[model samples]
Target: MNGIDIHNYVDCNDMFRAAANFFAACCRCAVAEKGVFNVAISGGSTPDGLFEELVKMKDSLPLEAIQWFWVDERCVKPDAPESNYGRAAKKLLNRLQLQLDNVHRIEAEKPEAAEKYEKIIRTLLPLNKKGLPVFDLVLLGMGPDGHTASLFPEKFNDLPGDKIVLKVPEPEHILPAVPRITLSMQAINSALEKVFLVTGNNKMELLKVIKNGQGNHYPAAGIFQAAWFVCCKPGSQD
Candidate 1:
């Protein structure tokens, strides 16, 4: 939460269009500079609009050179109605002409789900001098409770020290699931850039509170190091 950048839209439709353009431009720039674009995505109602917008611009963007990964995922079957990957698959991935191998999914069904996803990330991402993977861009969404990824305020005890992926139990009334695999704070901050897609009137007051440095109870406030924070909401004046 490095002071959120608010880009107000007249409605959800307008917000989605702007978000799609931002993502497309970012992907194009990354591909031009690095030959490929690696992006970690978040799941939420807000992001669903963005994903739908992205689907319409498949030809205009660098879909072929983009490698996709999830920032976090619910512990459920791939085709489960509640599965984020499943939603993304039907909304975007399944409609694209991109290679199936380019889409890396978190194996939530694996015995050691978090560890398996971490291995997958390590195999695909470039390592730094400290042997940590550095991502190009990470897309995040803020929950109504201000939790981002799987780092709920009440679930701090479940935070991982491995500097990779971890399984966090959902706090009651927060997420509607058991354990979820998510990237650690260290991993998310390691990305060269980050983008937050937050929308709706319900989020307006909380966004203001977070910017004023009053709400530290939420884990999303820990993202002070993120390079960029983008907001999409109606009449939202930063």
Candidate 2:
């Protein structure tokens, strides 16, 4: 519940540029030190902007050294419009020259999908002496409801386990057709860097409440080590 580094931008385009720059820097740093970069990405309108920006910078960005993963994904076929991976594939991954092996997608259609995805993540991650997967960067998004990575305020009680991948039950009226698979808070915080891209006027009040440390009930409150960029209209509060 610590205050995150807040960066406010006048518009979504500016936020996208800044996010792309941050990703490029992290990719370079990881490649220089470890020869590989693992990044977990969230799905939302804000990330779509950043993904388009990254696509534009594909030539300059270190595309080859980075391994892409989703922080959460809707349970759907890869070709579905509702699929987070499908959106990213259309916007960024498909445009890049990076190898298919570098994109580790959540198996949304598999039976026991969350457990299977967890196994895949465990295999790709570099184990420490105690056998924990360490990530280079994790990019997140905030819903107006203050949820992040499929973790909602009402669902906080369900988050205490040590599992890397979690199966989230579908919300009553959510858009996605099935359940969700998301990385747990433990896995998310293990990343070297975490970034959040949030936008729009509807979220300002909740953002303020979160920054004031009044709403620990929200899953977004679990993100203590991340740097957040809030893209708002001109003269919006931070």
> In model 2, which regions exceed 4 Å deviation?
128-131, 235-238
What are the clashing pairs of model 2?
Answer: none
Worst 10 residues of 2 by lDDT: 169-178
**Candidate number of the best TM-score:** 2
lDDT tens string, model 2, 1-238?
Answer: 5658889988789888998899889999899998889999987666888988888888876677889999998888888888888888877788785698999989877768888888888898886554556789999988877888988766668665778888887855456646888898878878888899988878988888888899788789888878998888967553
Question: Once model 2 is optimally superposed onto the true structure by TM-score, how far is the C-alpha of residue 45 displaced, in angstroms?
Answer: 2.2
lDDT measured at residue 228 in model 2 versus the true structure, 0 to 100: 92
After TM-score superposition, what is the CA distance of residue 123 in candidate 2 from its true location, in Å? 1.6
Kindly list the per-residue Cα lDDT of model 1 for residues 59-173, writing each as its tens digit. Answer: 7887778999999988889998768788888877898866988999998867688887888899989977767778888888888888889888778655666668888775677
TM-score of decoy 2 = 0.93
**Candidate 1, which segments miss by more than 4 Å at Cα?**
1-3, 225-238
- Model 1's lDDT to the true fold? 0.78
- Model 2 residue 26 lDDT score: 90
- Candidate of highest lDDT: 2
